[model samples]
Target chain A: MSADRPLEKLRVLVADDSPAMRGIVRAVLSGFGCDRVFEAENGLQALAVTESGGIDLVICDWKMAPCDGIELVRALRDPARSRDPFLPVIMLTAYSETARVREARDAGATEFLAKPFTAETLYQRIAAVINRPRPFVRADGFNGPDRRRLERDHSGAERRQARQS
Target chain B: MSQAKPYEIINPPNKLKAKTGSIPAVNPEAIKRAEEALEQVKSEFRNWLAEEVRKLERAHADIHANGLGGKHGEALFVVAHDLRGLGSTYEFPIVTRLAKSMCKLIETAEKRAAAPRALVDAHVGAIRAALIQNIRSDTDMVGRELVEELERQVIARVGAEG
Candidate 1:
């Protein structure tokens, strides 16, 4: 609960079909000092909000109708359609399987939070995106935040060469 | 890099604005107020859960009467999934665990027509019992044992079919 936490100024959008889930997320964001929290019932609505601009972070559910979290992330990362392709998107889902996590990551989500998450866990994620923002990657196959979770000291030349090859 | 099109303009405009360079400080009073609101929401958990249980019960009946693979099965999965995610947040860890197990049971069932009715019933029953007995903790020995038994049954049934 640091007074200078980065979450205080963030305008977060929480997208979920369940009203209860949306309320809980808004409450958690409020605890983090986020005064401007918006809600979307599905990915379609979430996309509209994202397109309208000014959304710093998105916390989206996986199993929404008309559009799911993966579809939303893909749309946001698409250079032709995205308003802010670099916007941090966090996928909040109950499906903790490897396949689902991979799908979310490949679709350009900045982070993945499993459902039944604690308040502390949520805080840590928001902090991660704020304090330690990742450089966005725009390679032939990938167009989102860097997917690497591990930190290493590879040389800049080596990294660029690796990406090119 | 290509510039993306601006979003469609909505009336009254969205209230969310871009962040300034300096992060705002956390207000202790705001945190306290949010916590109070959360507590108020939790206080109404029993009624909400009861309503979910009724929906689940109806879904179960629909499945039994008309068989699975229809809207009833889908409804059952949706409700169970919601319970799985919300139970722990609302201080009902046992419900979360049970509902998670139930979700898996439904997910792995080979065919809708072949769903294990007894196993589904056990899970639904355990959820109701957990709420009635106020079994909120996953560490509760009785609750743990019940969950394990239900999981074992589901695995065995699915295994047998496979």
Candidate 2:
């Protein structure tokens, strides 16, 4: 995040089934000095944008045909299939249930933002992803950010070896 | 003792920070700009919301013409779900509340078949009323009562217990 225009250089992609919601999200992203915003009507389109390259972050909706947001996240986190396996994703949708949040987190989402969101809320989520990037975790049947509750300095291979051991 | 699940953690390069590390996370000016940007598009909200409402009504109308069994019922759920997400952003938080209650009523197809049509009608009517009456929130008396009743009925219907 920058001082005057934190998201100026950031290229973000918004994926939802609704064109109206996409427009609204674009307007907000534009407000944050994010001139390089992209829109996708569904998860497949979002995948195309991400695969083509240059998208910094993704704000995805949970419901869409052919491929939904959760499916998209799973695809993105698949090391064999994804162009950027560690891409930061913020799941934004109307589903506010604790179960849904857990589902999104388990799908490899970097952060979660429920809809009817204000610019401040959106900004806070984006900032959290950037300012505190999580170390990616790869385990049996799980591939995503480290699911630890606390944040710690993970700057060396020694710490990685210790955790694996 | 059970062995710990073996996992490898990799610290991906923080490109975002590397690109813009000097900037602080909380930028008041940027937030203001974003709010202002939202305001810029506020003019089109009414028409956009009306269109969405029409979609909901059409889906509901389908439920009327055809019974609330399969596609007709699922269609209604889809529109209500979208409204549940869109109402507040469209500047009608009341619509969101009503639509949410509507969603609860028909969250699943099984629930849809069991749900009383009258309850669904109340939610649809309330959403239309919010837009037609220009009621933004439940602060207004009618809005408050309608929401409370709708939520009460939906909770009862869905076994949510309100």
Candidate 3:
């Protein structure tokens, strides 16, 4: 309830090959009062960690060994392999180009955070995923957020829940 | 890839909100605290940066030994890309700038062979110099000019390729 511990209860997973980066992100998350942070070296490991369940949020690097971020997102979105297809995923990458952003989106990433990222930027991204989650669209070549959202209101929670039913 | 057709939109439950969104207002102190936390470990950042630079050098060595064509060139790109992402975080934004330029120069294996070896070496050298000399950010005028010149050449090379 206090401002200092807003992220205290959140369980976060950071998937990156760089140990330095993992430590930096873990430090920042710890500063935000998030104690349950998980680390994975690549997408495959991230998948293993998530498949075992109990991960609240995911922050993943775009480039990784064997299985990259795109592959991870796709795997997580797949019904057969994923435990929680609706889980929120924040795709972390240095590629800020429109094509790469679109690629991540189409692959089913819930959010995108470009690298050279600041702590504030990372916080805002976490906040964005929490404060606003786009409705998942089941369509051709896309299984994530509705890419064509036009700012129309969702009305209310009950209405959304009813639609899900 | 959605088109003008029938598509189902499912508003998944805001599980994250249920978990940690009761307090809508973000605390600025959270960011300040995170920054301070990073500062507490600032001394170690240089060592971490040096290790990354050495990895970049090894990748560059692979480029020299294998002629920037196969897995070796890809390795160079990976190291440069990681540095481009982590340099600023490790307190060397100038390294980030140089790495970004380097990334643009040899982003793909196809471009690696065509990229001038000297230009690539200059980027690798500048990155190491930034770490060794403690040129952390773009505030250093020489570092800024060096990055700009390298970026210019990379761009011109691409333009010529077109």
Could you estimate the TM-score for every candidate?
0.81, 0.92, 0.91
> On a 0 to 100 scale, what is the lDDT of residue A36 in model 1?
88
Off by over 4 Å in 2: A150-165, B1-3
Compute the lDDT for candidate 2: 0.87
lDDT of 3 at B111: 86
Give the poorly placed runs of model 3, Cα more than 4 Å off: A149-165, B1-4, B159-162
Docking class of 3: acceptable
Worst 10 residues of 3 chain B by lDDT: B1-10
lDDT of 3 by residue, A29-129 (tens): 88888989999999999999999999999999999998999999999988778999888899988777778888898899988989888888888888888
| Best-matching candidate per lDDT | 2
Candidates' lDDT values, in order? 0.75, 0.87, 0.85
Enumerate residue pairs that collide in model 2.
A2-A6
TM score of chain A per candidate: 0.87, 0.89, 0.88
lDDT of 1 by residue, B1-162 (tens): 343322221121112223434233334544565566578678777777777778788888888887767677877887888888878877888888888788877864354457677778889999999988999886889999999888777667565223
Which one wins on DockQ? 2
